[model samples]
Target: MNISTFGLGYVGGVTAACLAKGSHNVIGVDVKGEKVEMINQGKAPFYEKDLDNLISQAVEENRLKATKDVKEAVENSEISLICVGTPSNPDGSLNLDYVKKVCEDIGTALKYKNEFHVVVIRSTILPGSTENVLIPILEKASEKKSSGDFGVCVNPEFMREGQAIYDFFNPERIVIGETDKRSGDHVAQIYNDIHATVIRTDIKTAEMVKYVDNTFHAIKVTFANEIGSVCKRLGIDAHEIMNIFCMDKKLNLSPYYFKPGFAFGGSCLTKDLSALLSKAGELKLSCPLLEAIIPSNQEHIDKVVELIISQNKRRIGVFGLSFKSGTSDTRESPVILAINRLYEKGYAKLFEKGYEISVFDPNLDKSDMENLPSNIVPLLSPSLEEVVEKSEVLVIANNDKDFKRIPSLMREGQVLIDLVKVIEADEVKDGEYIGVCW
Candidate 1:
């Protein structure tokens, strides 16, 4: 494969060298003549371990070259990889001027090329930029349609500096966000020589994955540092504590708490987090991320409440009042808090007009009545069917297996707002189904 890599910097330089070593003829493009001259002389443009050697090897083998002309680079290559820098703006958003300029250059050059070239964006961009921004520029400049006259896919690079070459060959997984199957398959073909987990999905998901990966890394670092501050105050070994905490792969270091859904509200998470925040306060430690957990959780609940209220339904039904499924414990359950707010919101309308809030939880029995809030007692329905039949809006607050049938049972004009994704969006076509965070 003849590949043209735009931006002969960190990502682009390493990618050009590494892919060239993989037996692909890589043509590196850059506006800077220094980088082009350095690559052409069989020398690395920047300082990355093993990068110079790879570049020298590829160039010596006649598999790698560099050029300042985008037209000549794109005209000779079957694939063009955009690895330009998207540095931060003053307000912390991505400044895409470099990316846009490169796209315009490539689009102008692509107009003359007759081959069905694949344009792969390896730049770190936000979701919708590829389909909404770059593709439009390419289509307008080239005067051709995507996936027909050309192909485009987003293949975000995940290489750390100083370990770029090793990371490229030995990645944990490879993600290809494609507009069409042909484009995805063509992008996947480039990694045929490497053995790694390859997942092909839609363009938006692939674009968002890079941000999620980076932000989660930031979250992990912030969490560790905050806990380390608290540990240091008490003269405790933070590293040892973290090592032990990381040993529990089943729950701690695993995907147990990673699911996207409603906010967490249980006996353990809230109580423990609050205790830690209080301790941090007492120790005079400023842990912004730690302190924001409870408020953020409440914000999620408030968002759900606002969503429900915006429907303007007089009668609302809530399924599953427990903190989660498979439990009768209503202690610190987010749904109970939401139910209280809904009851208060609805009762105010009772003064002006008429409104009702009904709830049903399979785990709740006579013994659980004392565990619920005082305001929600009158709202509890005897049976799920009664709640479903009487309500104009149904809210699935937990992932109970019984609530899966609610979508099939929905009637016209009724709306189902799912907090835990108990039903698919397509399942409730008779009426309307909305997921809280989907």
Candidate 2:
């Protein structure tokens, strides 16, 4: 395969050299004469582990070269990889001037080219950037439509600094976002011999994957540092504590609580998070991430209240009042908080105007029912049919087996606000159903 890389900096330089080493003909394009000259002389422009040797080997073998002319590089290569830098602006937005300029140059070069070309963006960008920004620029300049006259794809690099060469050959996953099947297949051929899972998706999702990974990494680091600060104040070993925390693959280091659902409110999570934040406050340590947890949870509860009030229905029935499914504990339950807010604020005026609210939880005892407001009736009926008969809107708060039967029991006009997604999406009427975080 003939390949050309733009921006002969860290990412571009490493990519060009590695591709050439993989036996593909590579031509590196850059604005700086010094960088181009260095690549042509079999030398790396910047310091990277094993990069100098790889570049030297590729150049010596005549598999790699460098040029300042975009036309020369584009005409010679079938695939052009954009590896330009996206630096941060003073206001924290991405400076895409370099990216746009490179696109303009490539689009201009594609004007005279006759063969179908594939442009793969390996630069880190925000979601919608490839379609909303890059594709339009290319189409306007080249006077050609994407996936028809040419192909466009996004193949974001996951290489880290210092160990880029090793990471390149040993990637955990390969994502190729393409405008067409031909473009995806062409880009996938670049890693035919590499052993990694290949995921083909839309261009925007591929662009967002890089940001999601990096942002999660930043969050993990901050969370650990905050925990370390609290531990150090109490003369505890933070490293050992984290070591034990990471060992729990079932929950801590797994995808247990990572789903985008309702706010968590069990005895353990709410209590532990509060204790840690209070300890951090006592030590005068500012753990912003830890401090934000409770308030964020509160905001989610408030959102549920807003959703309920938006329907403009008076009669409301709630399913599962416990903190979670199959539990009787109501302490710090998000559903309870939402219900309280709905009664006190949402239906304050409506309650006196003959509006009704009822709750049905299989686990709810007469003692647990005492916490609810006087106007909101706690149903003592064993059958869920009775509760559904009296309500205009139903809220499913937990993933209980009993709640799964509510969809079949639902009348035509009744609205469902599901926080647990107990029923399949297709089983319910489209506009009548709403998920908390779907």
Candidate 3:
């Protein structure tokens, strides 16, 4: 593919050389005359590992060249890769001035171009930035519709500064968020020679992937440092402890607890985290990330309660009362905490304003009960039909096998709230469905 790479900074420079090395005709675009001159002279404008030699090779082979004119580059190439910087603003937001300028220049260049072009955004940006901001700018400037006259794709780069060249060829994953299948296909073909996981998703999701990867990296670094602080206070080797901790990849370093859903509850997580924070507090160590865990978890539960309250339904049916599915233990169950808050404290308040919660936990169903249950235990329905019959709002708190049919069982006006994603959006035939985090 003929590629025009805009922005000749760290990411752009390395990308141009590497792509050209992979047997693509790369035309490097930049606003800086010095950078353009350096690239055309087969010299790296900035410092990067192995960049100078690769650029030297690519330029000498006539596969790579640099130009200051955006029009010339865009007109010559089939796909234009926007590799401009999205630096941070003073208020902690992204400053996309460089990206916006490149988009405007490309849009103007596209106005005169006759061939179908795919504009791939390789800069790191927040979700919705590509679709909401850049696409509109292209449309306005080019006087052409995106995904029609031209195509758009957000292809975020994951190159570390020093190891950029190595990371490019041996990427863990390649994300191509495209407006159309044709655009995605074109972008994916760019990496056909590389052995990496290629993920094709919507434009917004692809844009968000970069931010999530970076944020998680920041979290991991802070978490390690905080543990190091705590270990230093206890006269323990932090490196050894972390190495041992990381060795349990099945639970510690794996995707065991990374799902985007309800607050974490259960005996182990809450208990262990609390103990660690308490010990850290005794040493007067301020671990903000560790400190925020409990409150952040509580806030998630509070949001669930708030969602239930927002439904304005008096009769509420809760499916699976335990912290998770297949568990009989109710110790520190988040759903139980949510239910406890729903009940009225006094007799005066009980009759005034409170929800009627009917729970149907397969593990907690007392078939031997002859009488009604208490306010704490709530109404434990013997059958799923009984809970479905009595409640106006049904909340699925866990992933019990019995709750799988709840979406299909929803009545006309009832609201089915799913915290564990047990029910699909299209499964609910009658009532409105809502996912807690989703």
Candidate 4:
């Protein structure tokens, strides 16, 4: 591939040198005359590990060169890679001035170039930026329809600063997002000999993947720091704790709680979190992340109450009233909060004289009956059929085996408000199959 790399920064210079060493004819372009002269003289413009020798060798072999003229670079190369910087603004938004200016230059260069040239953006950008912003700029400046007269692709780079040369040669994955199949295929051929997973996706998803990887990295760093702070205050070794925590790959660091659904509430989680928060307060150490956990949990409970209020139905049936399934402990149960709010709001009443408000739980203990509200009824239905016949809105709060059978017993007009998501049944057709957090 005849390649022209723009913006002779860390990523650009290293990539041009490596590709040139791999026998690709490369032209490196930049606005700085000093950098161009340095690269032309068989010297690396930027400092990187093992990059100087590679650049010197590529330039000496006549496979790589540098220039300031964008037109000359575009005219000689078959594909151009944009590696410009996206600095941050004062208001925390991204400043894409460098990207916009380079796009304009490339577009203008394409206006006179007769051959179909591929423009690949290797700059890190937010989602929808390539299609929403860059494509329109290219279309306006080139005076040609993209993918018809030329090709465009976004190939995001994932290189560390000091180890860029190593990362360029050995990447975890290569993502190529193209405007057309020809552009995608042409861009992919450059990595024909590389030993990495090649993923071809749409432009927006490709653009977002870079940000997601970086943001998740930042979050992990902060989380570890927070744990370290708490451990240091308590005279405990944080690294040893984390090492043991990470060893449980199934739940601790894996996809155990990665789902986007309802809030969590159980005897152990709620009790442990409250104790840790109280300990943080006694030490007078401000742990914002730790402090926010209990409130965030409370917010989920409040949301369930609000959703029940939004239904506007007077008659409600709640199944599985305990904190969770297979337990009779009602302390801090989220469903109790929902039921209390409904009773206070005048929308809920006790079971009518003959029309019993049906409830079922395979694990509810008679000793825990004191936790029930004074006004609510406690008619324990042994079977789901009797429960389905009594209430208009069914709230499944637990994952009991009996609750799973309630969906099979569901009538047409009854609404199912699932908090634990046990049944695969629709409540009031499609509109009322409400999951508490789904």
Candidate 5:
């Protein structure tokens, strides 16, 4: 495969060197004469571990070359990868000037080329940046339809700064966001011999994946630092604690608590978080991430209330009264708070309005159900069908297997408010299924 890369910056420089090592003919294109001259001389302009050696070897083998001319680079390759920087503004938005300028140059070069060329963006960008910004620039510059005359894709790089060369050669995944299937296939073929998992998705999703990975990484770093601060104050080794925490493959340091669902309100999580923050407050320690846990939990509960209020239906059925499934405890349950808010909102009582509200918990003890509100009619029904049949809008506050089956029993116009992502609720077409934190 013949590859031409623009910018000759961090991403482009690394990509050109690595792709050349993979036996692809690579042309490094940039506007800076110094960067182009350095590449041609088999020297890395930027400082990176093992990058100099890779460039020297690729240049020695005649597999990599550098040029300041976009015309020459595009004429020499079938694919053009845009690796220009998308730096940040002071307000934290992306600075897309570099990306736009490179796209214009590529689009103009593309108009003169006869063969179909693929334009792959390896730059980190926000969602819709490709379609909303780059595609328009390319279309306007070339005066031709994007998919008709050429191919476009958002193949975001997942390389860390110092280890970019290694990360490029050994990536965890290869994500290709294409405007069309043909573009996807063309981009996918470039990594056909690589060991990474290939993901072909829509353009927007691919664009968003880079931001998600980066933001999550930032959160993890901050979380560890804040935890370390508290551990240091207590004369404990935070590293060892996190090491043990990371060892719990079943729960901690795994995908166990990473699901996008309802906020946590169990006896253990809620109580422990409050207790830790209280201790932190006594020490006068300002742990933003730690202090934010409870408030974020409250915000999640508030979202559930808003969902219920949005329906404008006063007759609401609240299922799973406990903080979680398989528990008789109702302490700090968001569902409990939601029900209280409904009471204050002037909704007629279930018995008074002659509209039945059923609460079913297969795992709950008989005593727990009997102790609930008098207006809350506790049903001994073992199945979810009874609950779905009784309510105009069903709210699933737990991931109980029985409750997960309610989507199948949904009647037309009935709303299923899901606090737990138990089923394929997003794809269910029977009725309006709303996830509290999807």
Candidate 6:
């Protein structure tokens, strides 16, 4: 495959060398004469582990070349990979000037080209950047429609600095966000021999994957450091603790609590986080991320309250009472907090003229009913159908299998505030349904 890489910086240089090593004809395009000259002379513009040798080998073998001419590069190559830098602005947003300029140059070069060219953005960008910014520029400049006249994709690079060559060849996953199937297949061909999982998705999801990966990595680092800080104050070995913690692959280092749903609320999570934050406070150590956990949870509860309040309905039905499904425990339950707020706002007044709140949970019996607020009417409904029939709005608070039947039982005007997304979006009308944290 003929490939052209824009911007001969770290990402581009490494990508070009690696692709050329894979036997793809790679042409590196750069504005700087020195960088272009260096690549042409079988020398790497920057130093990276095994990168210089790879570039020198590829150039010497006539599999790689460098030039300042975008037109020539575009004319010769079937695919162009944009590897330009998107540095941070003062306000913390991405500065996409380099990316935009390179796109324009590529688009202009595509004007005279008769063959279909695939433009893959290997640069790190925000979610909608590819479709909202790059595609429009390419279409206007080339006077061609994407997925028709040309192909476009957002194939984010996962290469780490200093270990660029290793990371390139041994990527954990290859993500291809394409405008069309042809574009995706073309991009996927570059990794045909590489042993990695190939994920083909929409352009926006592909763009956001890079940010999500990087931000999660940052969070992991800060989390470990905060734990270390608290451990050091108590003369405990944080490494030993983390080693054990990570050993629990079933829960700790797995996708156990990673789902996007309601705020975490159980006997352990809320209590443990509070204890950790308090210990950090006692040590006079500031752990912003750790400290913000509980407050962020409170905000999630508040958001549910606000969503319910926005409906302006008086009669409300809550499907579950426990902190989670299959349990009767209400200690630190987010649903309970939301219910409390609703009662305070006169949305839970049972016998009053303003509101009526009815709740039904298989786990909640007469004894459990005694602990709830006086305003919350615990319905002795033999079936969930009875509760759904009476309430104007239904809130699915837990991931119980019983609540999954609610979507099928939904009435015409009834609204569902779903914290656990058991109901499919396509199953209900758009305005009549709301996902709490989706």
The candidate scoring highest on TM-score is 1
Q: Write the per-residue lDDT of candidate 4 for residues 96-133, one digit (tens) a residue.
A: 88998999999999999999989899998877788889
Location of the lowest summed lDDT over 10 successive residues in candidate 4: 348-357
Ranking by TM-score: 1, 3, 6, 5, 2, 4
**Measured by TM-score, how close is model 3 to the native structure?**
0.95
Candidate 3 clashes: the total is 0
Go through the candidates in order and give each one's C-alpha lDDT: 0.90, 0.89, 0.88, 0.81, 0.83, 0.89
* C-alpha-based local distance difference test score of model 1: 0.90
lDDT at residue 381 of model 6 (Cα atoms): 58
Would you estimate the TM-scores of all the predictions? 0.96, 0.90, 0.95, 0.75, 0.92, 0.94
Q: Which regions of candidate 3 deviate over 4 angstroms?
A: 344-354, 365-374
| Greater-lDDT candidate between 5 and 6 | 6
- Candidate 5 lDDT trough over 10 residues, lowest sum: 347-356
* Model 5 bad stretches (over 4 Å): 326-329, 345-357, 370-383, 425-427
lDDT tens string, model 5, 132-209? 999999988887788878999999999989999889879999999999998888888788768989999989999999
Residue by residue across 1-438, what tens digits does model 3's lDDT show?
A: 899999999989999999999969999999899999999999999998999999999999999999999999999999999998888999999999999989999999999988999999999888888888999999999999999999999999999989999999999999999999999999999998999999999998998888899999999999999999999999999999999998998999899878777778878999999999999989999999999999999989888888988887788888887788887777778887887666533222433565477888888645423222345463677788889889998899888888888877777999999998888889999989999987
lDDT by residue (tens digit), candidate 2, 1-438: 999999999999999999999869999999999999999999999999999999999999999999999999999999999999999999999988888999889999999999999999999999888899999999988998999898999999999998899999999999999999999999999998789999999999899899989999999999999899989999999999999999999988998877777888867888998887887888899999988888999998999899999899888888887788988887778876787787668475865575566778898777766765454444444557877888889888888898888888887898988987787777776237889887
Where model 2 places Cα greater than 4 Å from the true spot, the runs are 348-355, 358-394, 401-416, 421-433
Q: Give me the overall lDDT of model 2.
A: 0.89
How well is each residue in 183-225 modelled by candidate 1, as lDDT tens digits?
A: 8888898899999999998999999999999999999999999
| Residue 260 in candidate 1, Cα distance off native in Å | 1.4
TM-score of 6: 0.94
Point out where model 1 deviates above 4 Å: 344-347, 350-353
Using lDDT, give the best candidate's number: 1
CA deviation > 4 Å runs, candidate 4: 297-438
Give per-candidate clash totals: 0, 0, 0, 0, 0, 0
Better of 1 and 6 by TM-score: 1
